[model samples]
Target chain A: MRHLTDDEIQGYLDNHPDSDREKIRAHLDICGQCRSNLENYQIIAGQLNTDHIPALSPGFTDAVLSAIKPDTQDVPVEEPSRLIAWMSAAAVFILGIASTIYFTGSSVAKNIIALFSPANITEPSFVSRYKEYISGIDLDLTLVFAVALVLAVIALIDRMIKRRHKPVSFMI
Target chain B: MDDKTSIVRKIVAGDKRAFRLLVDEYQRLVNHIAFRMVSNPGDREDICQDIFMRVYQNLAGFRHDSRLSTWIARIAYNCCIDYLNKNNIPFIDEEFDETISNMPGGSITPEQQLYKSDISNLLQKEIGLLPVKFRAIITLYHLDEMSYAEIGDIMSMPEGTVKNYLFRARRLLRDRLMLKYGEEELRQ
Candidate 1:
């Protein structure tokens, strides 16, 4: 007689199929090796079933609870709308760029016009004004760059502070 | 509403007390999965925390289709898999013969044999040594008392595959036991 396959033996152990189970039972009764194998499988199954689950460490619930930040009230806090924030930021950036261009372009245009004016090109007074205009443009550019650098530094510091203050959910 | 639904609703409604209650209720279930999947005792707590945080963050999106426990379990299982993949831990599926040959061998003293707990402890250690998949299936099936279908849902595998894994895992454990303690000791 052919021996039962592992699947068949497992099915028999699980009581999966009625007919197949009966066939295995008959075979086990007649065959010592299969019977022993079946017993071995049964013991292992029993042990697997009986294995104990270790309990969570003491204060486990408290640890989890402590990690979570509790809402102050039942009502959810209304966060400032992100769309409004983005639109405001975009408006500020556009305004800054537009104002810089308008001021610099107007100054440059005035200097260029003054230089090309037939009478004013050689005038000492016009030359002084043109030099002043050039210096003013340089100063304006320097101020804009300084303001941008300061804003970037402030934003970076603000981000670092927020991250440092953010409550960590896990202990580690 | 069912208890689960009521609890979930309270949690989603910014009820910290309700969330605490939910955590208390499911801590063991999460711990069981995390502990079995992660061998390192130090990492288990962090993994459990991460799983619950994910659950809490996504609580608002939870539809009532599946049981809350199953949903949490799925999150836990995914977290475990992520931990394994992230750490580059090799979850090799060793063949039965290979596992048996590598099984730790030493005769149990007569005194040790007298205590059944030692045998059970050895069995558990061997279970822990099984591949990640096998450890997961064994824990979910036997310790958590989850059905094969639930395990399949959590692990994202077909039910048949779950059953096959379960069987193979158990057989590997059995073979390990036979090798470690001899067939005579196991038969008793």
Candidate 2:
């Protein structure tokens, strides 16, 4: 006959308080480790069987319930985190820069026209060249408006695309 | 109304006084379970109160299919387990020392009931150090004198599993106690 495994002996050891039970009896005869383990389990179980439950503190239950229960009238309001505040600030800055470029573009075009007026005709001098160079700022400002418009359009399109697709957090 | 159903009705009717009625009855039971699971009075108190307050808030959602005690016991057990995992607090709550100190050997109680035999003391310490579930299984099955069926109800586990836990908990208890026995226990 095949001998009982350690698990069966362990199982028997756990369920049977009497160490002298037949299955445990047979197993212990042959296996020293099983015998030792069984004996140890008994000693432990015996000790545990006598344990006392802890006493309740004075008004302990009431104290605990009171401590954790939120006030009925005034639930605490939650504040948004720092990251959200930073994102809002960045959005405001970007909008300000774009608005500045848009408003300045027309004024820049008017100044470029004024700078080219014919009354001041010292055409061959370095100062005229320097003035022309200086006059380019208006065109450059218009160019900034153009670039800003393109960037705003691209950003809008990007936002629209992202919104349409709407990266949803799906959990399976 | 059936007991749990009546309690539910009272809590739902917004009878704040009825809330205390529920607490008075279930507090010891929940505290006992939490105390066993966490092994600390303070942490056990925290867990016990958490379970009840959760019950209070979620009372409207309570279905009367299962016993209220069982439902709340599950809550108590789960909260203790969560606290252990979240804080890595080693299942034995800080208040466990207070409970341990109050145990038969551990407590200074003059009551004969508090007087722990040496072997019992060794076993208590080991159970105190075991995992929360192991501690709970022993407390419910042996300490509370609950049957496997009752334990199954409290834990929402099958009776077979409760038996398994009880046996394992007992064996573990035995092994730990034997360690302190030296050769004297063996020779005996």
DockQ per candidate, 2 decimals: 0.27, 0.15
Candidate 1 lDDT over B1-188, as tens digits, reads 99999989987777778888888888888988888888888899889988888888888899988888889999999999899889998765655343466555435556546654466777777778777888888888877788878899998989888888888877877776776667786766
lDDT of 2 by residue, B69-107 (tens): 667777777777787788777754324332323433333
Worst lDDT run of 10 residues, candidate 1 chain B, spans B96-105
* Candidate with maximal DockQ: 1
Candidate 1's DockQ is 0.27
TM-score of chain B of each: 0.88, 0.72
Q: Which stretches of candidate 1 lie over 4 Å from their true place?
A: A15-19, A29-32, A72-172, B92-99, B103-117
Residue pairs of candidate 1 with colliding backbone atoms = none
